[model samples]
Target: MKIALIAHDEKKKDMIQFTTAYSPILKSHQLYATGTTGALISKKTGLPVHKVKSGPLGGDQQIGAKVANNEIDIVIFFKDPLTAQPHEPDISALMRLCDVYLIPLATNMATAEVMVKGLEHGDLSWREIVKEQEGNDI
Candidate 1:
């Protein structure tokens, strides 16, 4: 499974903690993340991550493209709702793509915890079926 990890500036600490705590479950799969978030997670947890641009600098759009292509299976974005984001449109597009593609997305820690656990238990194996169907269509 390919998992995307993103976080707002204010929520970066939380994202780091979450990744560190779940490193055991996360290390088995591919990990993708936005710039600073990816750097931090990699530094703290030593998990190899494919890093894209900073979210404000088009990382969200990059991830959205992956979702559209069915290359991403899960998204864990720890957004800071209290703070207004300058790149709101990009964020919205990424989230909308997740919905359109039926990818699992977690906007908060609680939801992320559940999704990570689900991944550990193979609950997300359905993504492979979806990918196979996509290939057949192609």
Candidate 2:
């Protein structure tokens, strides 16, 4: 499975800890993230994360594009609902794309944990079947 990790500035620390805790399970999958979050995860957990620009600079949209194209299976985004984001529209678009593509999205740590565990327990094999069907359409 391909997983995308993203976090708002206020939630970066939590993202780090969460990624560290799940690194063992996560290491087996292809990982992608926004710029600073990716750098921090790589430095702290030694996970190889493909990175796009910072979120405010368009990373959210980049990840959204992958979701729209059916390249990413799961999205974990730690949003700071208390604060205002300059890129709110982009974030909304990303979430909308995930919904449109039927990609699983975790906006908080609890859901993220469930998604990761689901990946570990072979619960996401359905994604492979879905991908195969998508290929047939092409």
Best-fitting candidate, measured by lDDT? 1
Error of 1 at 58 (Å): 0.5
Give TM per candidate: 0.98, 0.98
Q: What digit string (tens of lDDT, one per residue) describes model 2 on residues 35-78?
A: 99999999999999999999999999999999998889999999
Candidate 1 C-alpha lDDT tens digits along 42-106:
99999999999999999999999999988899999999999999999999999999998899999
RMSD of 2: 0.6
Error of 1 at 130 (Å): 0.8
Question: Over 4 Å off in model 1, which ranges?
Answer: none
User: What is each predicted model's overall lDDT from 0 to 1?
Assistant: 0.97, 0.95
Query: Candidate 1's error at 38, in angstroms?
Result: 0.3
User: What residue runs in model 2 are displaced by over 4 Å at the alpha carbon?
Assistant: none
Clashes of each: 0, 0
Give each prediction's root-mean-square deviation over alpha carbons.
0.6, 0.6
